[model samples]
Target: MTVDESDAYVLRDELPDPETFAHLREVAGMGPRSLEAIERGLPNTIYGVIAVHEPSGEVIGMGRLVGDGGAVYQISDMAVHPDHQGKGLGTGIMDRLEAHLEAEAPAGAYVNLVADVDDFYERFGYEPVRPGSKGMHRRIE
Candidate 1:
């Protein structure tokens, strides 16, 4: 899917080039788990999208949906370069991601994400998992 923004940005699902992925990692302050997952090819299950600055051919923003591809999908690693944060790039990326999920994920699949910003994701139909539901994690030490 291609999403063209009025600002001359374009969104495409072509797996990000390595340099772009590295830029995304740096912008997001991603930790070892993210590094490992990205490096070990584990996030290959990822559905990745990038916001490109057409004139420069630079990736200014990115996000990914990762899961088993059938039942559970989580939006993760969403980021926009600090220089580009206020211009709606993040929202554009999510718009594309949500559209993909709506069209492709199987019926009854639970789409989930951990949001660093409270109100931003609500606009996209994501709500916190109910209070008692656990969000678990294990990190390599």
Candidate 2:
């Protein structure tokens, strides 16, 4: 299926839909609770644009911005399906997310993303937090 820009709307709508939650899990290598977290937190978060294929209506790429609106916003769960990689879909999602953050986020709003690829997010203007600072997480078990 061709990745049409217009199909972005379909992705946006599907981001919160439970039907596509499984697809998200596969892409992110996460479990059902991850999907639950997304569903639970989606209302309080700011999700940016998503891009999908038109013909099969599959969710090919997705990214989202989370955190408090004014003080902090984080880019999270950016993923493109395996079959859809190397075609700039991830970049397209980031472009949309950045554009949204740029236009909407207040000054001093800290935007962050935990990137799997070392250099990829740098191209979109993300950098390591600091020398001493580090990313922390806790998993429920």
Candidate 3:
């Protein structure tokens, strides 16, 4: 999608529709998700934002926060459509999520995410896990 000078991008506090959300993930080289899972999971987001291309009404980007409401929080599912990458949409998504965390996260809440690009997240003040503290995960088979 060619973003013309006149094309307006709007960021709204809402989850992308499942089709657009899944498509963005697929095109962005992420895994696909079932419609049923999308339907069930989106409404549980503590906060989320979707960037829409005004001219085409396309969901070009998205970011979401998830985890226990009080003690733990995580920023996840941050993705922008390949065509829309480098247009500041990723920063916009992170800006919104960071704002939410700043305003709402409890004082002692532990926030974290696994970064594919350390530099991108480092700018936002997410540092490497401290020495002797390893991040681990197990994928569902």
Best by TM-score: 3
lDDT of 1: 0.77
TM-score per model over all chains:
0.82, 0.80, 0.90
Where does candidate 1 clash, by residue pair? none
Question: Whose lDDT is greatest here?
Answer: 3
Residue 64, candidate 2: C-alpha displacement in angstroms = 0.6
lDDT of 1 at 108: 99
Residues 33-122, model 3: lDDT tens digits: 888888888888899999988888888899899998789999988889888778898999999999999999989899999886657998
Better of 1 and 2 by lDDT: 1
Model 1 per-residue lDDT tens digits across residues 1-141: 775553577888855655667777687765424544566553464577888888777888888888889999989878887876788888988988888998899899989887867689998877767695887787666
Q: What is candidate 2's CA lDDT for residue 63?
A: 78
Query: Between candidates 2 and 3, which one is better according to lDDT?
Result: 3
The worst-scoring run of ten residues by lDDT in candidate 3 lies at 1-10
Better of 1 and 3 by TM-score: 3
- What are the clash counts of all predictions, listed in order? 0, 0, 0
The digit string of per-residue lDDT tens for model 2 on 12-65 reads 522535446557657666445565665676566576556677777777667778
Off by over 4 Å in 3: 1-7
- Rank candidates by lDDT, best first: 3, 1, 2
